[model samples]
Target: MKSKYNFQVQHEDGSVFDMYQMGIWVESFHIYSPNPDRTFLEFPGKHGSYLSASYMKNRKIKISFQVETGSEYELDQLKHSIYNIFYTDQEFIITRDLSPGNILYALQNEEYDFDNITGEDADFNLTLTMADPFVYGQERIGTLADDAGYIDYNGTAETKPAFSFDVLAPITHLDIVSDDGYMRIGDPYTVEETPFEPETIILNDNMNTLTGWGPASSVDGGTVAGQMSVLNSNDFIASDYGSGSAWHGPSVKKSLSQQLQDFKVECYFRQAAYVNPKDTGRVELYLLDINNNVIAKLAMADAWKNMPKNRAEVRLGDTSNNNYMVNTSGKTDTWWNDFQGVIRLERIGTKFFAYVANITRDSASKHFRTWFTGFDDLEGKFQGKVAQVQLHLGCYGTDSAPSQAFQRIKVSKLNQPVTNQVPYIALPGDKIDINFKKSEILINGEERKDLKDFGASFFSFKKGRNNLFILPEGRVSTTVTWREAFK
Candidate 1:
């Protein structure tokens, strides 16, 4: 505001004010850290208390200063300016020269609590409260070129960035996917969904006995149940000197209690114990219809074709077992030979979405990557069609005799299907704004969010480097802007 004063505020109408310029002298500026919003609750017979949730309350800022009053005319004019800036019901963006990297969004809290000293100098103690907890930096913007599909973001903390661009062609959906997040703008059939009270059944459970499973071995590898189920090589041989058609594999089947409407199946496994990635093992989750024919296939191939570094390959919704999903990584890092991850296959209404996440006891749900079944009438193909799913892993190299360590086989079912729709379309020549901070979508400066799509997640960029893949490269010029935030 006026040549970088000590304290300043920006109003919603773009007007700015500096503290010293308005004859205001600061005595002491106190900023208090907010108390945490969680409550400590004791269990029925437990010794220690536990916190319910983890978050902080709103922050409080107190600005104590004095305003000068000289002549009668000067006194009236100065007090009027103070009344105009403070004592407002609106929230203001406040800044300070001390915290140059941070800004505050606050509203006037409580009363002005001022005193008139001899009608010459007026002392004022103003309190402001902030709903947002973090201190923010100035907004920095960048552009993604025509051929680029990735953005490497570096920030002190995670931020909700805004995307803006003019569309060169008409597009129904602008789907952006990252390792930790997913956002689809202008998706016609699928909206934001949250499964309430999901019922998850552990099918082909290895912790118990592998009862429903059978081996239709093309090669010599067999299955064994232990701490982790092992789909090991049958005997010692070289890597793939035999026929590929009659491959080594194990398949398990389970019947659904009722006809399926929506489903989610996950296979948690380690590719091998001592070594895994180099064995070139493939774990295919087959969703079969009532007649035991395959309807959908989500496969995770570790080190395809026995290459060392070519790990983290995933295939989705393929009938022929080929055609890897573009830009899908099953494992978080490719170089690790002992990779432990979870493969998830889900159906929302007619659309099928596949997601993979690297999991560990310390860091659960790490690096989530997703791929959609971008095909036509996938709903009609498997509405009431899916009866049981088969978990199969096969075609392993006999040298390592790698037994794929199968962990948990969890099949969670939603109480109801997700049919909510949020259609956010950006036409040719239209300027698009996807505001994750405000959780708002504005096309050409107009808000178009409706009740059907309420509480939709706009998705955000996490801390450190966020690698994002925004597809169909050359059609749209992109600009992303966000402020660096301190915790």
Candidate 2:
């Protein structure tokens, strides 16, 4: 008696067919045992032979069925349908109750045999070779969320499978889809195993909030009132002082108990109006230690006696009154009044570098007038820690309110990890090909070199979710696609 069984064939293009609907009855299906490829080593002195570990090779499957047709045309159609399954170079997913899971297989050796046709009816046998020896679940285990920032995966089988996802933003979260699973990743706020934390935009205020910063000294600290001091009609931090007073402007500090080794602090400022040569003072930005000692000072002096009229200088200062300028050059008075520039301070090891750039009116242009200054050995005086940052507007010759507007102040750490998420994993023995397009690809926080020469890279999923991140440089979109293999 022919054993009765139900089975379905799913094409590579996602079309499925039930054998019964096509007047095809499955007589029986047989799956051969997995064949393991093994090796042996013989030693001259050893009495017994050594057997190497064995690995299961591809398995073979056979399906026996009969096709019934009422007419010659119908018989031709049924034969063509059966030929469609074996003729094309595509894999088909075959599900059978005898197999523990769905089998991924394709035509084996292009071999098919049929008995003599009797009245448009025929019995046939088909051979198939499993692409992967191990059966896999019909359902995939991972999902890319709508936002593409969150990826979740649930363990479907006891075995581990490789997984991958794309990153469109600086921060992302990869979590195990299990209810009790506790894997959270790609957090920008928390720094893990790295010397420097992620770059933080501590203060990006557009005159909206003024909290946590220290009080302004010579003037009201927060947003200043009046149109004359506005830049592009935006409210800014202003310093107003009466005669006889030297220091003006506001200062903000972050207390650090030796947590930071290297950092970069930057801000933008411009003189609200023109100043007389004699009455013009200096605009200073400096960092101080715990004891209120200046470690570094970036100052622009408006002295008439200077060779170029206005000189912007970077100086290194210590606690013992030792102060010397690292670099100084003349800047035009026109550049001073419209001084929309950025002051950046970078501290690395024992060396400090200062950069000042005069931004052009058209912000789209990268060309800018800039100056750089650097020095070493300043950390010895300040105990190797910067505890305070002060932005000051002062007058040297005369004590008068200097209309200086400050905006776009920011502080960030240097050399921090670009992406802190771990790579998703692939199961052992699974081969996956990942393709990236229109993206600046980074793997494990480093630029992937293989992608530089080629458009795609192949990965062998090593029994886990593979950690992959894609960041689109411009208007381009990022996408990732792959197929999983099983044994």
Candidate 3:
């Protein structure tokens, strides 16, 4: 840490400019303690006015800087850089050594003046007008199961937070009630169905919670495969394991695989992190032989180290051609784009089929696709090892690999239909991001303005513990995220 006078300027793009780095120093800062607006009632011929109510107003700030340069060229270039850095028509952040956790949301909207001498030194002043009366801290995250939830909030002032729902079942409407009233989605919705009938699921894992084979699981660290998957606002993390929070689910054992003939391994998942095509680690939906060798796999990774191109493909026997999007060459650009749901590879009788479903124009449809035809082909060569197989969702040996999240996976020959308990605002595999601060709602990464009820409005959380309930909630989960406020 530097002295109290040192200042740091952070841009929106994560670029930072330090006063000490560029031979610049904070000359001084002129700030008046924040004041409050007051209302008063004056009685006839009264000596003093009666105080009614008071409200804090936005704070104004002014800071001066002195710049010293080594050469005339350096001085000229430095002046232009300073002007461009602070004079942009955007909001930047200012932090001081004196204030460790507080961030000054400074905008160069107000009047400012810049002056410098060509010899070696310069001076300038910056003025800012803050809209919010209180300072804000870092964001805090919490999760709620149904309506009964109790979480500690460490904040002084009232804060408006954003929320996201990882809906577990079908519901007609979602109503979260509080002392004032309730927040609800009143618009009508449609529930889409799978293209085929699913029956006798061999394995099913609802990524809503972290439970693989329940207690006494095994993988890299004696856990489930690709178990390090991440999802937003998810309560089940890498650590939320053990017999206490473990859920009873089905798994594909070695004996079951021996009798299995027509097997369909379906993965309902979403890419938790998609910065670009070339990510840090890859994600895979794979099946292993008795010896833990890769029999077949659906991988999302960069093709090669030399040629770091992003791709999503199905592998038969782990060859170079099979690794770099052979049949899945062009079919996976959409999944790499925004794959809506279900990446599946199954063996019906003797022939193998691969299919993927994606959302195009606000609609999700599974396109029945296959690259392997017979045993003579590259993919069909692995048909002999299909029966003696075990299920694993993530990459082999790479415990903390890809940033993809599996929502619900069902391993069944013929798909089946399961109706919702009741009509709901959202259902299983339906992930929604709702922001009260911005008045925005994104359903499955897309904006949904039509779902807003006639009187649906935004609300905030008060300081300390809040007692609230989500109505019509049987098997639904919601995660709340908020930054604290301070006076």
Of the pair 2 and 3, which is ahead by TM-score?
A: 3
- Cα deviation of 81, candidate 1, in Å: 2.4
Q: Number of clashing pairs, model 3?
A: 11
Clashing pairs for model 1 are 186-424, 218-246, 218-247, 219-247, 219-248, 221-234
Estimate every model's Cα lDDT from 0 to 1.
0.58, 0.51, 0.55
> lDDT by residue for model 1 over 115-221, one digit each (tens)?
87766777878788887766788888877765244545566556788877678875555655667776666544323642223344435354344556553222113
lDDT by residue (tens digit), candidate 3, 227-321: 34335534222322222112211123232334344567765554432444333333455565555555566644433322223355666654432
What clash count goes with each model?
6, 20, 11
Model 2 lDDT-worst window of ten: 219-228
Give the Cα-based TM-score of candidate 2 against the true structure. Answer: 0.40
lDDT at 324, model 2: 52
Per-residue lDDT tens digits for candidate 2, residues 316-433, read 6643555454345435544544466666777777777777776644412221456667767644643345666665555433434345556655655544444553322212221222
lDDT of model 3 at residue 377?
43
Model 3: lDDT equals: 0.55
Candidate 2, residue 340: lDDT? 60
Measured with C-alpha atoms, the lDDT of residue 294 in candidate 3 is 55
